[model samples]
Target: MILIIAKALVKDESLELFKREALELVKNSRGEDGCIEYSVYEDQEKSSVMTFVEKWEDRAAIEKHEGTEFFKEKIGRLISYSENIEITLNSEVL
Candidate 1:
């Protein structure tokens, strides 16, 4: 299994729109093949800070998701709303 963590510092003016798009992204991604889990979170003290946590069967599953039209579109939009972003991948310990 693999875990993906995407953290972003969103622009203040784009907060609402970012949440809307991210919600749809999470919902759609959850239904994809090999999607073990997908969720989004916000920092209570810093609303502009957002995170996306995803669990997949493997790297191939993540690649498949990245190739999806909605994924491409939404991710592009999300990135546009962010001041900065960081992404990391992890492998589950056996």
Candidate 2:
């Protein structure tokens, strides 16, 4: 299995727009093949910060997700509102 943890510090004025785009991305991604889980959350302490916790069946599925139009369009728009973004990928040890 593959896991992805992503965080973004969004512009204060752009938070709502970012949330809309992100939610659409999450909703669509959850229905894709091999998508084990996909979720987005807001940071309690920082209204401008958002995070994504994701799990996929494998690297190939992750790759496929990256190539999807939904990702290309929505993710691109979402990042435009962020001052900084970080992503980490991991595989289950077991």
Candidate 3:
């Protein structure tokens, strides 16, 4: 399995728009094959900080997701509006 933790910092004024876009991304991501889980959440202390927690069956699944048009479009829009973004990938050691 593969896990991805994606973080994005939005401008305070762009928070609402970021939430809406995030919800749409979650909905669409959940429908893709090999997507084990998809969720979006706001940081408790910083409203402008948003994170997406994603689980996939494997690296191939994650790569397939990256190639999807949905990811391309939405991620592009997010990059345009977000102040900062980062993605981290992990896997079980045992």
Candidate 4:
């Protein structure tokens, strides 16, 4: 299994737009075939900080997800609304 953590620092003026796009992303990504789990979380202390936590079957599943049209559209728009973005991929050791 693969775990993906994506964090975004959203621009203050763009929060509403960012939330809308992020919600759509989470909602659609959850329905993908290889998605074991998908969710977006807002930081308790800092609402402008958001993160996406995902579990997938494997690397191939991630590639396939990246190729989807919705993924392309939403991610692009989301990037535009963020001050910075970071993503990390991990494999379960246990």
C-alpha lDDT of all candidate models, in order: 0.97, 0.94, 0.90, 0.95
Q: Candidate 4 residues 28-71, lDDT tens each?
A: 99999899999999999999999999999989999999999999
Residue ranges of candidate 1 with Cα displaced over 4 Å: none
- lDDT measured at residue 66 in model 1 versus the true structure, 0 to 100: 98
Runs with alpha carbons beyond 4 Å of true place in candidate 2: none
Tell me each candidate's RMSD, in Å, in order: 0.6, 0.7, 0.9, 0.6
User: Whole-model lDDT for model 4 versus the true structure?
Assistant: 0.95
The CA root-mean-square deviation of candidate 2, after full C-alpha superposition on the true structure, stands at 0.7
lDDT of 3 at 38: 98
Ranking by lDDT: 1, 4, 2, 3
Better of 2 and 3 by TM-score: 2
Winner on lDDT between 1 and 4 is: 1
Q: Which candidate is the best by lDDT?
A: 1
Which of 2 and 3 is the better model by lDDT?
Answer: 2
If scored against the real structure, what TM-score would every candidate get? Answer: 0.97, 0.97, 0.94, 0.97
